[model samples]
Target: MLSMLKRIIIGAPLKSTELGEQKLNKKKALAILSSDALSSVAYGPEQILLVLVTISAVAFWYSMPIAVGVLFLLTALILSYRQIIYAYPHGGGAYVVSKENLGENAGLVAGGSLLVDYILTVAVSVSAGTDAITSAFPGLHDHNVIIACLLVVFITILNLRGITESASILAYPVYLFVLALFILIGVGIYKIITGDVSSDLHAPIGTPVAGISLFLLLRAFASGSSALTGVEAISNAIPNFKEPGPRNAVRTLMAMGLLLAILFSGIVFLAYYFGIAPKHEETVVSQIAAETFGRNFMYYFIQGTTAMILVLAANTGYSAFPLLAFNLAKDKYIARMFTMRGDRLGYSNGIITLGVTSILLIIIFKGQTEQLIPLYAVGVFIPFTLSQTGMLVKWLREKPKGWAVKLAINLTGALISFLVMMMFFITKFSQVWAVLIFLPLIVLGFHQIKKHYVAVGDQLRLTTCEPIKPIEGNVIIVPVAGMTHVVENSLNYAKSLSADQIIAVYVSFERVDEKIFEDKWNKWQPDIRLVTLQSYYRSIIQPLTKFIDTVEKKASESNYRVTVLIPQFIPKKSWHNILHNQSSILIRTFLLYKRNVIVTTVPYHLKK
Candidate 1:
């Protein structure tokens, strides 16, 4: 039943040849990889308003300028990442670029930062998605955490199946969300131009708390910068694209940037022009829709599409984290299990890990986007700076053809990103300082893992090519309880390997049983000799294990090999296994640990 469920969800185990069938082209890759950035518009502008509305009216007016600044940063990032795609076509992203240009330590820092970013992406995206639903259906407010967790679980299952499958499933919702936003923008603009101002425009007069400060406005820009968190994911997953993977990934990245720029501009513009202020209860986007369309069907359509894309936006993180882990594992920085693919040709372990971590974050933060927001961009922009700086270094040092143009783009991106990072760093220090300690520890962990792999390789190196020892005689030891068909079957097979030293050992705790077994053995007169030993402790495996140890020492002295054969009964039904007492199983379990000792389980099929 479990296997069937697994088969249905993740699909049947796929052959290595079918991998090409699973690769996504650029058109599909854009929808799958850009969900986070695209859906982020649902809350990114809202976050800016939330920060601004708490201050004075003058600060509230600053939202447009801040949005423009963010747009400039967004443009710089897209151009820099396109260069990243062309230079490191095999999904180098930030970690590889930083590693190659800076050092292994810098690479680890970038990797650790991205790990945190991917996890928070899932958490924040799901939380915001749930928030979108509760805005429309207020009764869901109490169950936000549960709903958010379920959304993460759903996305995780989709991702575990395969990228192409997930892309096809989610592409429609992304298109729908984009469509809904454009409709909202276009309609809102028409209404504003016609002088049909929303009757519900209630721009509240701000009672200033710490009046009109530059720091507060910068903090607002930093808060809204979360929209840019997912832009690097495409470059990280270039290998998953169809042929010409890098070119396809670059196209997807460009398409995503253009869509984000348009959506962000529309949402921020509508929010300001429509007199939509951050409400404690409703989202800024929803309010813009309601004020523009007056709680009509179009408003709900916008909310519905927004909810869907927001929940599904987590797909971006699911795609990025697993492949990043695969890369880290490839370099021996993480566990090799992460490098293994699942039935769907996806990094199943890493996907499942991201899901579990996101669920924990959801539960911890109570699925509140505001609570999770403070921890978001620090992880994101650190990688942004590193990637841009790495590319800058790459261009300057290598001076490849056309390097001058690339260097200017990356340097501008790095400088802008570094400045924005400082804005978040000073304004939100208490919120993100834990990362300062967390990142270094993770880098040390990478070094430790690399060290462990190196140590294991050194220990397992072939030191000598000579035969194991001076002797070459191979001996097989069969442990039998008494004369039965089970014993007969084992000896018959043991005879085929070598008749030289096939010893059958019998362990008896009492004389009465030993004599009965001895009489039966003698009566049957099996060709192989039987050796009996008495144990006062009533232990069968302990005595037999000691005997095997002694034989192993003698075999080593003679350069001989030792094999232990144990016969097992095959029950017709699983419950029938409980009917019989198992001693050979106990024997095989212990004997397997001894060096140079071979343990084999030969099953005797019972017709009944």
Candidate 2:
């Protein structure tokens, strides 16, 4: 039943071969990969206004300048990641760039940072999407965490169907959201130019430049820079694109960048122009839509699409995190389980892990984007700085064509990214202390996993070992409670394996009378020797284990291998397992860790 349900949810896992080389064109790729960056405009501009509004409604006008600063950062990141897409076409992004140029430690740090960032991306996206929906339908205001978690589960199921399927299913909402935002922007711009304005807008605030401190403005920029979170995703996701993946990826990167710049800059401009404050009941984007379209059909339409694409933006992390973990697994920095693609050729383990983690974050924070935002840019920026520095070193060392130009671009980008990272730390460090501890722990985890894999590889190495020889000789010991068909069957199999002695031992705990069974056994005339062990403390396992140890000690001096064969009864129904004893399982668990000791069980089916 679970298997059938799984088949229904993820549309049955596809064969590994079926996952080969199918590509996403510009449109589909944009829907799946660019959703994170594009959807950020929903909260990014509002995050700035949220910070500014703390001082007064008068401080709200500063949002325009703060947003401009974030725009500059966005421009630099877009150019930087475009170069990354060209250079690291295979899609490791920061980890690959840093590992090859900087060293293993740097690579692990980048990998760890990305690991945290991608996860937080999903958490933040889903929460903000829920916030968007609740803004539209106030009745859902209290259930944000539940709805957000359900959305994460739904997205996981969609992605489990494979990359292409997810792209197709998610593209419509993303495209529609983009269209609605553009139309809203156009109409708002026309209203500004042609003297047509909404009467519902509250009068504008006028906080002079002298009233605002540089620190306050910088903090707001740091907050709004969340818009830049998903830009490098394209560089990290070249493998998911169509033919000429790097080329297609660069085009998508530019398209997503242009869209983000337009939407972020336009939304902030309109919000400030209309004097829209960050309201607790609705979003700045929703407020802007209300001002532009005035609660009409287009207004609700825009709100619905906004909620959808914001939710769908989680697909970016959904696709990227598993692929990044797959690379880490291949490098032996994480468990091999992350490398195991499912029937759909997706990293099923990583996908499920991502989903569960995101849901936990939502529950912990109560689906509040404000709380999660401070934990955001720390992870996001570390990889940016590392990737740019790695590229700077690469350009200087390789001195490729246009290396000078590339070096300057990367150097400037690295400087700017470092500054932004420090700003994020300084301004939001109180909320981000967890990230400081979290990233290093991830790096330590990477090292520990690497060590374990290395040890396993060493132990499994066959080059220095001798070839196999014959079993030499076998002495089989059968543990028998009494003579029964189950015991008779096990003894016959043990007899086939033993070259010489077949000893059938009975452990007695004073509960069973075995003299009658002994007489019957002797009457049956079996060739096996019967050894009886008595335990005064009513313990069967202790005496049986001691007897096996004694035999093992004796066998070590000879060329014979020791085997303990036990009989087991199989229940007709699974629930019948509760009625049976589990001695075989206990013995097998003990023998598993021993060297050159074997334990086997023969099962006899029960009729009742």
Candidate 3:
């Protein structure tokens, strides 16, 4: 059933030829994988505001500390995953790390988390982009879900076509967004420092609700940390890089990490400096842009760039999801379809599946960025904790040179990630507990599926009790339709069996024509007795069963073994089965039920 779903969702499994043609270079691959982290700069600030809105107005100032903490954690994670890329350059991501160091179950859990995270990434990024665009053009607010889904479909098609193509197209817009944002922040800061900045456009005192607490603080930090969601995507695509893959991948990751930190931190600072208050309906980026440039051309540019980045941010999931899914498929934790590449040598099926799932989420959530933010952090942090823990175990087990340093780094990362996850659970339980529950159920389902495969394999074992031998006094019963290639093949097969007696049997819905029999006999070169059976209802199984029973009775009386050769046409196309034909399967099944009888199929392959 899962395999069927994989096909329906992802298309056909990819072949080696397809993969060979679609191999991605290091620079292009890095850009594709890093898109998610880079795009987070646009909406990461807004997510901070989402949590702070329920607290006191002072909670808006908390963006600074949350950004700082996230940057600090982001730096540590980058450094840690640099080692991951170096250690396993073959693109395992969290699953590879946990499987190698922790255990298979840990790997499965990591995979489940990563899968959920990738889906959330798409929905969140697109929804956030839609919010930015709507903020810029209020007329678009009502159609946000429609627009978000359209973008998802567009990205899916691009990804399905080829990774390199998608990367090349996305890189220019991403770079533009980065430049535009940095320019906006730099100009905004200059205005503030020069005493040229105007009155804040955001609400004044009593903007946010009162009664802020530590819970709201933690929620704000968790929401801001959503910017760090796609940090691990590059680790999964390391193998797609050029020679010295891990080295180049590590370099790319560091570059992405530093750039993300600067951009996200700069945006948050600008938003705070401009007195941008947390509002359930507004995005901080757009709010900052309107305040800084006052709806001018530059402000529009910033808003446009923010929207572009948010949309492109989903490209990060496009690259990472397929790679993670491929690894899961390789480990048999996911359906084998994910392991298959497309003609473009990409995980096309997985890409489309992720796109479709994300689109559904966008529609269901009505493209509300605030609502999706809670579900976003949980999946990402689950893998973050497991991967960090796996690294800690690796440092302990291998005891490599500078093992103490590595262990400390891993331990710190694991501890911090776990605390964040726990806090997210406590603070956002009503909003995100559903994801936590669903992820484990998915993990358990994979385990059950694996067990079923193992049990079936055990049962299918060929035991020593069954031995091969030639039957004495072999009688061949050839069940055929009108003289065709299938019947000819059956006669040849019966000859090869060296049967003591051979009879060609035919089932008819009505009386057999003598002239038809005479004509068939004339064409036959190998001599064999002909027998006919009549079925009033034209049912093949019932008549064939009766004939087989009579043959078994005679065989028992003569102490001879009977071998039935049923002629069948091998279907070359999926639609070929619609044609009316005798059911050879029924005849073979009935023959197998009788003792001292062996059923052999003589098949004629049909042209497609």
Instruction: Summarize candidate 2's per-residue lDDT along 1-608 as a digit string, tens digits.
Output: 66788788887666656755446788899889989989988888888988788777667777777777777777778888899888889998899999999999899998898887888889988887888788777899999999999999999988888888889899999999999999999999999889787634533445364457788787888788877887878887788888789999999988898899999999988988888888877788888888788889999999999989888889999889988998999999998999898878888898999999989988888898667776776787888999999999999899999888888888888987898788888988888888778778888999999999998887778864656455667778888877678888887777676357788888776645656666677777467787788888976778888888888888867767888887887887877787778878887788777687788888888897
Residue 403 of model 3 has an lDDT of 87
Residue 412, model 3: lDDT of 78
- Give a tens-digit lDDT track for model 3, residues 14-81: 56655544555655665677778878776678878767766644567777778888888898888889
Query: How many clashing residue pairs are found in candidate 3?
Result: 3
Ordered from best to worst TM-score, the candidate numbers read: 2, 1, 3
Which is the leading candidate under lDDT?
Answer: 1
Candidate 2 — what's its lDDT? Answer: 0.84
TM for candidate 2 is 0.90
Steric overlap count per candidate: 2, 1, 3
Candidate 1 residue 163 C-alpha distance from true site, Å? 2.0
- TM-scores for every predicted model: 0.86, 0.90, 0.77
Clashing pairs in model 2? 14-343
Error of 2 at 385 (Å): 0.7
Candidate 2 wrong stretches, greater than 4 Å:
138-142, 198-207, 465-471, 477-489, 499-509, 513-525, 529-546, 564-587, 599-608
For candidate 3, the lDDT comes to 0.79
